[model samples]
Target: MMAGQEKGDLSLVALTKSFATFTAVHPLDLTIPQGSFFALLGPSGCGKTTTLRMIAGLEEPSGGRIHIGDTDITETRAYQRNVNTVFQSYALFPHMSVMDNVMFGLRRRGDKNAKAKAGEILELVQLGQVADKKPTQLSGGMQQRVALARALVNRPDVLLLDEPLGALDLKLRRQMQMELKRIQQEVGLTFIHVTHDQEEAMTMADSIAVMNAGRIEQLGDPATLYEQPRSTFVANFLGQSNLVRAQVNPGGTDRIVTVRVHDTDLEVSREHLPYGVDDVWLGVRPEKLRLGEAGGPNQLRGIVRDVSFSGVATQYAVEMPWGQELIVVQQNDGSARAVLGETVSVSWAAHHGFALDASQDAAAGAELVEDHG
Candidate 1:
């Protein structure tokens, strides 16, 4: 059996990267506690990968210090650091057996128990039976486990996963997400995952840092970020949100604020309102709204312009009297469903609405459609 590995907390202070005239990563400070699964999530060109590379010592920082616990590894070479990286490509040595490939690193490090250590890691990754197989003999998921085993065999203080599941199909990708989480928990190693997939990050990471324009826009647990996004980019990027312009009524009570949207007056929690703003963009998630009679605290009248049905839920686009269309999603329960061309009133609780500064771009999260296209 192999010796237990020491887990180290990772910290970045003023880390920055630049490419001539453009800055890829702005100077930023972040701390990842030991044994936590932290994710750096963002769209392409947002510097998530660049940040991971810097942590792995593959990319020299333009300015910043990287620390693993008390040790400063900012100037250390990639091979000299106590860290390992698993990339999108498995990068396994095809000529060597899986067991041999895993032992190569340990043997190179002068460990006499390389074979035994490799065997233990193989079993840890659930690939013990495939230890004799070649890289080509394994499925995509198995090959990935082998790659992980090779890295973990070295007993690094931290593991960096850079879109490691990008090559797998949807079903396999999801399965790997769960497997990776299990592996991380079993090893208790600090895991820094870089990905653009929001669902994947939310599913596996204990905490996530949402990056945009080479800087972090928001950082929190998945539920906090989803239910109460601080910025328009985060609100729209993490998931769908219905943002409508509204004017906050002055002289409001401390616990609640009255916001006027179109012809409707919505009572929103003061805690959810943007700091020091009279005019704001009210935000609500589609699923949080109920399309029915106007008996709730906040209600709006609209004409059902379109309706689309998926197996699990039905989505409706309702056009308000002021000409703005709002989208609503309802579960496919046995309850009656709204039809197109019908006049309907949608209502929701007072606290369901979130407010942001009116000056912020209403189209902050609009890039998702173009990104997928």
Candidate 2:
């Protein structure tokens, strides 16, 4: 541990936040394991930021408790909490040098080894060589790293990052994502990152909690959540998914359900069904689908509407007889490309389809238009 820091898990019980008649966060329970990198991911107005702020003690909850290990800190002030936040704004003292900015927090806490500790953190973030340079002299990525070093130098039990890479360009954001993950692992502190970018959360976090409409929609590791989404919202939000309405075959075995989609039978694993229902939404990722002759158990014939070649892969939008489009992605391995207006067969493995309750909204994952007025 660095200086005054201690390793502790963070937990929230029935936490809620409201402003007048609007509730920003509903009462929910969450526990972040010690030294684990967790992410709160969602779109705007989803209460992810509010949840993070409540844990940081920057936003007081309307009800419930916040705890670090066994100690209740719900009533603790922002500065009194054993947590530090790194926001999108680097918030570095522009006039001060990188070294001075990193040491400022330590010196204020009356640590005698402030300079030594700052130097150590600077090296950890790979910014020791530019310690003498001011924030203006550094690149955006470098400034963000300096801000990270400053926060980590305090050695807070938990580090909160509020879209720290939002201001960076695409390439730089990808670079910083790996860098942040590396730094978090090296320091062994719990990191709670909040972001609207799905790729960013999936790339860096050990576990992710998908939030929406002031509640958690789903929570799991990256691969599990991506491969086996529990809801249509999660399936569409995390990545591209083709959801087709299907009905469970009447005499199917419990281990596998034969779903009828567009006059074709598709075998889906019964284990993927969350509830016992005859009506279901068969979900499959675009990459899981293949374009070929109709010889598989799950196969559909459609007219190719469009083709997009994106270097690594080719995406095809095939329009079915019912006017629904099925998106398929094929790796660019020198295979013959499908031509638009040509009829083709699309097939996927039986187990690749995930069944969700049909009662759920078919447009659950559609993007909401934000009111800017």
Candidate 3:
């Protein structure tokens, strides 16, 4: 854990898990500050669930340490850890009412006021009106709320949520996202949520740890992860991007460098770029690329291939001579889109793109090609 890590903070150091000859998760080192809404995001079998299970003590790590607050709970039993998990399945009893389900854990702990606490939590989750209803009588969203109230009834120091909103419809999922964030803020409990939904992670988490192939590719706040990704995987995974080939050239100071993209060569401030070599891959977000009104240092001429209206924004597929197709998205304000087959000038500012290494570019490019194809 870092020096500033506070009490009730969660820490995992050199955490590893394996099954026979296959390694499910590599050694992970992460320190989550107390009262933070943190997310472990990745695809299925990418080790995200395994990491969460380790933290919850549901699956013992093959090796490493797990700590909550100032105490080390590496070898602690699952019930001994001050953590509660809200799984995808509500796991509520079919015969029991909502209040009883919420009070189940507290009853096991022999709390004399468990019934009162359960009633209070049901109201907190806005399920007070359905306190006497069974799990089968409740809607999908209502069932999920009951699960959340059940997990939180004990007032655990940390809460683990594994795709808690997976079964809800799109509209309900959006509503629950806000509700979950609000509840976390109100309780001030550390939350470690696991999900594959990028938008959900972006909307609710204070900080996200994006995992790929059993390792954390990048971990930071949403703005930093989206604006200045350190690797190609990070850049391409979060959202749409235009990864153009480029060559780096020496500039005035060792910290600065010039990048050549296609037919344009422009100076760039390389303060955040760690790679000091000449060969690089530049990544630009779709919104950063402006159309029409030419004459810029980094400019490219391309023919518009396709355009689609999406209510809030318009998407365009532009083609270049190199057989590369770039995607650009512009907000809709009742303005007409550029006609297909029209030659338009595309340009962006220096701060809009980040240089990437060859290996990172290769990974990003392969994924882009696969996604577009």
Candidate of highest lDDT: 1
| TM-scores, each model vs. reference | 0.94, 0.94, 0.92
Per-residue C-alpha lDDT of model 2 across residues 179-287, encoded as one tens digit per residue:
9899888888999999888888999999999998898999999998998899988887788789999988876786877889878888888788766688998998998
Task: Identify the runs in model 1 with alpha carbons over 4 angstroms from their true place.
Answer: 1-7, 369-373
Off by over 4 Å in 3: 1-7, 252-256, 294-297, 334-336, 361-373
- Of the two candidates 1 and 3, the one with more favorable lDDT, higher being better, is 1
> lDDT tens string, model 1, 1-373?
3222334678999999999989999997999999899999888899999999998889999999998887888988887787888877989999999999999889878899999999999998889998999999999989898988898888788899998888888899989999999999988888889988888899999999999989999999998888888899988888888999999988688888899987678989899998888989999999888889533588898999999999899999999998989889888977679888999988887788899888889888567634531
Clashes of 2: 0
Full-model lDDT, candidate 3: 0.82
The best-first sequence of candidates by lDDT reads 1, 2, 3
lDDT of 3 by residue, 258-314 (tens): 677676675555765655567777777888777764323567779999988898988
lDDT of 3 at 212: 85
Worst 10 residues of 1 by lDDT: 1-10
For candidate 2, report its TM-score.
Answer: 0.94
